[model samples]
Target: MKNYFIVVEGLDGSGKTTAINTITKILNNNGIKDIILTREPGGTPIAEKLRKLIKYNIKGDEITNKTELLMLYAARVQLIEKVIKPALEKGKWVIGDRHDLSSQAYQSGGRNINQKLITYLSNMVIGKFKPTLTLYLDLPPKIGLKRILSRRKIDRIEKEQLSFFVRTRARYLEIASTDSSIITIDANQNLKQVQHEIYKILNQWLKIYK
Candidate 1:
């Protein structure tokens, strides 16, 4: 079987975890068991450290938009070089919680950074390497924020104004529309419905690989 790299993307509370879990179960049921789960700005030690810095203001210093974007690419390069590529080379299917798309949405859209610079960095750092499939859970920013707030303390990025996420979601949809690899899911539905959609979409996608 050919190894596949899958990425789950969404706002803070768009049910990416549930989608990942459902996808993993679907793959396992299909007799595909050599799978590795990871997340970005994470998945490696250095990346995890960068993840912390990116997600939280541990220090009093304010992270500039360009700096944040560069840090994300740095962490991403580390993850791809140290973890994702190695797993793929070993024939392990990798399911990621988030990936480059997050940088495009969050840093480029939310932070109002120049998209050209982001694209250039993307090309320079990871080149053409990307996920085989990306599941983007789409939902309203208010709804996502409400759901996340009820669950736990919000992170630095999560604490951004509602307008920020609005822009982020806009960018997500814009990019998803253009990218055939990205499949958008309506996450405003109930959990069961969302999972059903995810299962249905993933199951169909798996048929191609099989």
Candidate 2:
């Protein structure tokens, strides 16, 4: 079986965890059992430290947008080199909770960073590397925030104003519209409905790969 690098992209509380779990089970049921699950800014010891700083202000210091962006790329490079690439080389299907698209949406879109810098850093760090299939869970920022707020204490990025996520979603949609590898799923629907859509899409996608 061909190894695949699959990524799940979405806002906070957009059901990415559930989506990843469902995808894992589906893959297992289909005999694709050699799979590895990982998340952005994590999956490695050094990267995990960066994930903490990225998700929380440990020293209560303001993390500049540029600083945050650089840290994200640092963690991403570590993950790709140490975890994702090696797993794929070993014929393991890698399922990621988030990836580069998150930076495009959250940093470039939400933080208003220049896209050129992002493109430059992307080329510099991991040129031409991307997921084979990206499942983007689309939903309104308000709804997503509501869901997360009701469940647990929000993180640093999650504490951003509503406008930030609005721009982030817009960027997500904008990119997904033109990227053939990305499949957008409406997360506003009920759980059953959302899972049904994922199932249908994944089944069809698997056929193509086969």
Candidate 3:
């Protein structure tokens, strides 16, 4: 079977996890075989450890943005080699919850790190292995924040000031504008409506693109 790498990206509370679950079930019902759903920063063992460090804000006391970027790449490098690439090689449909694009949006956009440098670093680390398609669940940061707050405990990144999240979300939109592979899906709608839109996109992917 041909390989498919699908990525789902959005700010917190954009319903990414729910979308993935729904997509998985829908795909299975459609008899789409060889699907593997995964998330970044925690796909492999080593990256999961790094994911804990970054999310828990364990290194916050002295963590510079540069260090944060490096640590993220460190986790990414390992995941691409250990999880992503291997799955693709086996002709499995790999669905990523978040990927390098998250780094660009959060680190470069939220932290105001250099974009040229960020691009260089991303290329250096990721090379030609970008996700074939990404579903960008777009919604207002305030709404997203509210959803996140009601759903679960906040992590280090989540504990950041409101200003940071607002900027980060803008960055996600900004990057989505420049990438053809990214399909922006309206996320402000009710859950069923959002799922309907996602289902439409998935149907297109499976029928036309596949």
| Global lDDT of each candidate | 0.92, 0.95, 0.86
TM-score of each predicted structure versus truth: 0.98, 0.98, 0.95
Best by lDDT: 2
Instruction: List candidate 3 segments past 4 Å from native.
Output: none
Q: Give one digit per residue, the lDDT tens place, for model 1 in 100-133.
A: 9998999888999889999999999999999999
* Candidate 2 lDDT over residue span 150-199, tens digit each: 99999999999999999999999999999999999999999999999998
Number of clashing pairs per prediction, in order: 0, 0, 0
Name the regions of candidate 1 deviating beyond 4 angstroms: none
Model 2: lowest-lDDT 10 consecutive positions = 53-62
Candidate 3: residue 94 lDDT (0-100)? 85
| Residue-wise C-alpha lDDT for candidate 3, range 128-200, written one tens digit per residue | 7798889999988888889888968988787788888788889998889998899999999999999999988
